[model samples]
Target chain A: MTCTAKKCGIHFQPPSIILIYEDQNQEKTRKRIMPIRNFSKFSDCSRAAEQLKNNPRHKAYLESVSLRQLQKLYSLLKGHLKGQSLAQSLEQVQREEAIDPEEDMNKLDDKELAKRKSIMDELFEKNRKKKDDPDFVYNVEVVFPQDEQVESCGWDAESDEGF
Target chain B: MAAAGGDARAELDVDVDVDAGPGQEKYDAEENVKIICLGDSAVGKSKLMERFLLDGYRPQQLSTFALTLYKHAASVDGKRVLVDFWDTAGQERFQSMHPSYYHKAHACIMVFDVQRKVTYKNLSNWYKELREFRPEIPCIVVANKIDADMKMTQKSFNFARKFNLPFYFVSAADGTNVVKLFSDAIKLAVAYKQNSGDFMDEVMRELENFDLQQKGEDFSDKEESCPEEKPPST
Candidate 1:
């Protein structure tokens, strides 16, 4: 996807899950042909077992990492994601004229978009003051899920890492 | 043992759903699942949740006053999974008071910082808390902050073995392993939620040992000792 900003243009390669194809009675089909970009993300029996196999430090390495460590890693990534998003959004504004969020976000230059998002986020954070927890800090966006409506929302990609 | 089936019967008094087909209805899958994050304050709980919950993160102030909820939708391997994650505060005393907002979660995620030993030590208390409210939940353990120092990574591995919880070492700051942790937790949650049976006994057993409820009752020691108590069964 290509997004154009007033002064800065940016290109986007969506992480995944952009399309949905379903036939009436039969179950919806997943397009497996689509490449799974983040291989390291899926840590199940296979992934965990692989950790034991892949590295020489496996024994010693496994010793230190804990759930809290994962939690902190996630928080840090959220920051990374925010930066990526602003970049993507600024690109979006430049590319489309739809006036929808996709367009509105795309309209701003990267710096301008980042500035707006940062200002609002700063205002909320300062007012909310989540600094007390030092070892771990998370900024969560909570939205109520409506069960009845979800199934109908075509191409649901809510979990997209860059979402 | 059939008793395993019976005890499971007691533990499970959830409103039973009669089958859509002869016996097939019971095997019916749910469209939704609950995933909870538990950890200490300043350990990056809220920030991690925001990364996964929202499309991206905002470099703003973070204070987890109340439980924040986020939902995600995706397909794991093949099955469509909707993950409902709760980002909770990590303050010690607050940890106890909060999270009681719900019961019997499908999955639990515990996060700790690698550099700090205190966060590592508290995993015991956090694990105990998991057992209390949602005993049968599948847990994923994470070691955060690998970027700042490698020494902490050493500490992180040590912490993982103590709990035997599935461990992931990632740099949320650099965008490393962040997605993997989210994906894995959901997959495991779905796997465990679906196989509530295959692992049901194991989960109940874990709960028995780690149950904070039992520990809580013992600590309160408020039960009255009656000399002439009448048997209700009589």
Candidate 2:
């Protein structure tokens, strides 16, 4: 029996993650309410999402659900718990996931740096084309446009020591 | 419980469908009152809630949100009131509660541990914060854990008298004045909601309308939109 996850939502009052799914075998849509337990504003969203996804009761139904989606839901819940509006939470999540090229990563603390790295990793995974993808290309090469002058970094500068 | 009888004058329209089957006896609440609890951490705010709710309680913790919502179906002056008792799930560590915690709140239960003098002193700060958000709503000052030292109740607590607010000496451990305090709170909340024509309600209503508009486009769209991209079918 195959199940396709359709939608996911959070109920702030009772603080439960509501999932709507379509069961291929029965050809019916059903809802699953997963109550979030022992979660606090300071709780880790990723860890909580992983726990929920791997729970024995939800494991079967949430097979099609992505860990990132679960994490996103948890993040929203966290924001709401911190007394932030839904829009505020969404903006925060967007800000976290987005990497600013102008921002220096060297100044970030260990925990913050790790978070940024994880965001970069997730973004990379999303954009990567797997072998099974229809549009997957092998060894595709493109010529670099030399019209614009590129700023040279110290590493890119010609090394004084010959290799 | 003496104060409970005096406020019974506020009559609410009763549901005529009392004979509507065993399982279908749904009490349609006249008002949804949000009563928030504020106090220092480990002051037994959650314990007081638990004591009040007793067997009819199903603790709904949204620790991620840093609060536990205890829903109670209360009958005040023949009117069914759905009381949402919001307990700070150790949010006191943040020094100040989130502004959203006080949003649309009809009443507040400010508690402090009797044994801890610091907790008692911190009441002024909590009261100040609460008044900043909800100035018109009824605020109750509770001296909890009286079971530890019953003698403490004899000493005059001027904090409640200073603010001219109702005071209760409650013990979550042995359930002393727990029922009275909660019931009185519900009554006060219901009364406040009915009489309140405050500007805050107007602001909340507008905010709620804005929320409704956003709910359709932003909230639902995000919820329904699948994150994983499915392969295109030929």
Score candidate 2 by lDDT.
0.69
Q: Poorest 10 consecutive residues of model 1 chain B by lDDT?
A: B18-27
> TM-scores, in order shown?
0.42, 0.46
CAPRI-style docking class of model 1 based on DockQ: incorrect
Residues B25-98, candidate 2, lDDT per residue (tens digit)?
Answer: 11112356778999876667876787677656776787767778777878888876777788887677677887
Off by over 4 Å in 2: A1-163, B1-30, B206-234
Residue B151 of candidate 1: its Cα lDDT?
A: 43
Model 1 spans > 4 angstroms off? A1-163, B1-29, B53-65, B90-93, B97-102, B198-234
Residue B218 displacement (Å), model 1: 39
Go through the candidates in order and give each one's C-alpha lDDT: 0.47, 0.69
lDDT of 2 by residue, A28-84 (tens): 999989999999999999899989999999899889877777888899999999999
